[model samples]
Target: MARRGKTAAKSNPSRSDCSSTSNSLSRRPSSGDVKTDLLQALSAIAAQHVNAGSIPLAAALQADLKDVLRRWKQEHASDLQKNDKYVYPLEGRYDAGESSIENVARSSRDPRIDISLEVGNLSGADEAVVRALQSICNELGFAIFLASVERARKTLDEEVLDEAVRLVRVFLLDGGRVAEHVVLSPSEILGLQHLLPRKLIIYEWAAAISALEGQGQEEVPAELSAWIELQLLELFGQVPKLYVEDGPALATVLTPRRLKDIVSVMEKFAGTTPALISFLLAIHSKEMPISEETRQAAFKAVFATMLASFDITQDPKDVRMKANEQPYRPRSLDPPPKPPRIPCLDSDSLVQLTMHVIEDDTLRHELSLFTSQLGAQTTRINPLDFESLFLPFLHSLALKTTITEPHHEDLRTLFATTITAYHDRFVGPTPPIPPSEPDVADGSRRWVRPPVRCTCAANCAPLNAFLADARRHRIEFAVGRQRRAHLHQMLDATPRTECTHRTLRGGSPEALVVTKIDWDAVHKRNVRAAWEGRLKSFGGWMEKLVGAGVDLRAVLGLEEYERVVERREEEAPEEGAKDGRAVAAAAGELRKRKASEALVRSSRLQNAEGAGRDVRRRVAETVAVVDLTDD
Candidate 1:
């Protein structure tokens, strides 16, 4: 029996009471009871290991723990039901690493960390044993927190040093995606503290020089500095890029080649970021050794970045903030709206449409992006060359009849902002193409675009509608284009000897022709009058046509053109002037009527005198009475 007792004790290591020799002799230990005892013993051991700073034990305890708890609850049903103080301190044989009984008891009050203490009886654990277990797990959690901090510090130090150059390169070269995925903590950046300040100093010095030089000419706007500052803050997350050697020391000697490279890099990378350009401008200006051309290029880049970023529709407050050098509010994370669908269209077609689809706010936003890109390209280009650079595009768009909203006047603003009419500097291979001949095929003569067609009648009403709209838009666009062309001619026209007198030269021959009379506005008042008259006639004609069910736009023919011109001519007054014609006609009619009346009276009197005998015979009495009254 004593030997059996020793075997049972060995088999159930969890049980504190192993020397039950008499009880073992009385009845063999039940396998179920032994299993329960073993589980409780294992829990007690795990609880001690946790107290000794073992974090892994917590995870192990958590697995299959539910079953263990059920079994434990079954054995301690009475103690749990009674809610008695069943937990008691263990004897003086407690592990030296374990928390003191008092500490364990105190920690048992917390429901989270004291999970075993509060509910251990359900897991077949004594309350005192669970409390002791929990106290040690708390220590392990603290050790984990400390270990994480140390690991992070070591990792950060290594990463910052290793990635410092790459970070700077990525920040300047690919700022759009530089911050994705990777996040470096402030401390991590600080670890490479020795390497950050020189770049920052360079940036600051550049900014200062630009501010000083740019102030007088408005050459360097505040936006450049703001942009640079914002970009720096975003990319590096802190200033002082890798340490500086105090004062205005140049990072490197600004040799012409280096200056050129820097300018190129800035131009390529700046995009719409004005601040970067400003910083480069500052550097260029301060580096007096560089050629004037280099400085000019830097200036152009800065100007380009600023103008490309400009959005007239932006809130004034935002503009003011940028102007004042404030950080921009972070962009919202809302997904961008899906682009509008226009079938049978490509990007070039859309770009063309952008010149005409002015009223649609959504379309306007998309167009802004295109124009922004165009603006960047036009940075050094002259506005006088806008005809060569932009007219061909406008002409292509104007011929597309499917985009019918009347041209919004704001499109002019876009043109004016991007291209400068002050100089004729930019020259490219492409010359301006007339709207009438927008396309060429097989390197042959210029060709007109054919009327657009929808794929099918039943399935493409939207397409047809868009085409119709586009056509209408093209009409207004045509008018606007003509106006702008005239304006451009006026702008670019030089004093020329015409008949030996100085005169502004007329534009291309095509400029004199306008399909819509409204587009020819050199004599604006007369043209407007003609347009108003034409519109009135058109309204009446259109009503008649619609009533007659005439398909006016169904087939393109000379009849439509003839009808429109004839209607307009019939509506036009014979007099070139409208308002003054009525007054002049009324005066002339009054004079003619007066002259006719006087002549009629003279003829009647002469006839009466010549036929005096007949008159006397017919009205002798009346005539005598009239003579007596007169006497």
Candidate 2:
């Protein structure tokens, strides 16, 4: 009976044992339990590998560890949300000699990993490791910020945007490393277009584009290049405002090389002319101190793109007519013809752009860039166009006396060439006008009457006509008091003219009697004198431009030199001869006055000696008186 009872007890479990088995089967593993199991499994795997450097085994182990970590994070997501202070279990092992945190930090895009752990665990990190971790943090922070910006599309959260901007500023200011980790999509850039700081955009986008250095345009996706160009255009529009806001900070990021990079990127896409122009103008602004090399590069890119739209060798008039012609309408069944390529620059824009290029002191010196761009097509540039554009630029050069000596020779050459071109094209084979003597009446001593310049409709025209006739010397205008006063004022302004107002006894308007007095001789003399003064002034100006002793003929060209300088020189002698008698008479008068002054001095000397004798005699008498008194 005892044996049977013991068998039953062994076969049928106790109530407590049954309850323990059911609980063990039904209960889930806690986070602590899973973590302990994961650690034990990882330890066992590590212990089994005698060769710790076995690549296959290490790879398998890493794969398993990643899978386990991923599942654990997913399963324990609720727990993770509850605990904000949870640290990654493998955080310490990341920077261990056995593992490289740099690779993981660089390759990982998982936002679930607490990046703050890597950021805070920099106590004994190597410099490279620290930079890698910092780069990772920056990338992650930027990603989060971008997410917020994306979310902002639906709901405009000012707080989120502000915080995002602050975080982005930190990432951007950290270094260029962040750019390597995160590539901004077109949509991302477009989304943050208005929101992102321009300096930050410039730095990151510029760096990203620069990273694709060796890749060909074909290798780069067209959409990306297009967006990049659009982005650049948008940025260029904000240049003035951004420059004001960022000041010198903008310059540090959008450097000359960066500008070249941007231009190169734009060149890949079609119809980049307007944006390129804006870019050119932006860099050319007083704010941006772009280097000459970069400026030229930008100019080359812009002009090349601009010129591609039209045949520069064609006549501008023809081009204008063609451009203004109505578009060709197609039949309903006809395939749509290719759209006409619109010229990037019109005549006015081209002229204005050329003026700007010419205005830049540095750029003007290197006009080979301008000429080289025009290439052989320069012959087709209309003379009218030339006059409209280069003539004004040449005239401006005359006013630009502040040009330094280093640029003088180049400018002098440009000045000479332009003047020659203008003379040959516009002035046309006409002989240089010799200096003319003032017109004089055939038998009269008085000169030809000069024209009155007054424009008043009342009495000035008749008076001017009368004065203009060389034969007529005097004219009387019977007019009112006010009319006579106006006549007198006009006569006063006119050279070598006289006017008198006479009141009639019968209450008539005063007679304004106008007459010429030595008009021709006085006018000619004054004209020659003015020419001499202008010659001297112009000679001095030329010297200032090309340095002292530079030949005016060489700088001003043969025609201009002879017309301006030689003619003045030839007329100078005649002017001197006309003044010679007046000069001689003045010298003679000076000599006569000197002789009279000498005679007066001699007479005064004699008188002084006689006075000296009388004074001596008085002194002797006084001395004798004084001696007698003292005794």
Give per-model TM-scores: 0.17, 0.26
Off by over 4 Å in 1: 1-137, 140-264, 267-276, 281-631
lDDT string, candidate 2, 177-258, tens digits: 2311221222222122333333433333332332221112124466655654666566545432111112122232344535
RMSD of each: 32.5, 28.5
* Candidate that would win on lDDT: 2
lDDT of 2: 0.39
Per-residue lDDT tens digits of candidate 1, residues 1-631? 0000000000111111111111111222324542443344444444444344332333333322323334434555545442111111222222213444553555566422321111212221223233333333233221100000101110111111111111110111101112212222222211122222233343333322323233233343464445534443333333332111111112122334445544443444443232342243334434344456655555444444544554222222221222323444557898556543221112242343343334345455545554555445455433333343343443344344322224433443333333232111222111211123212123321111222233444323322243333132212112234444543353234232010111223534222221212122325444444444433433343333323332222211223322331221122233233368785676677668756865874687577644222322322332232232221
CA lDDT of each prediction against the hidden true structure: 0.31, 0.39
Best by TM-score: 2
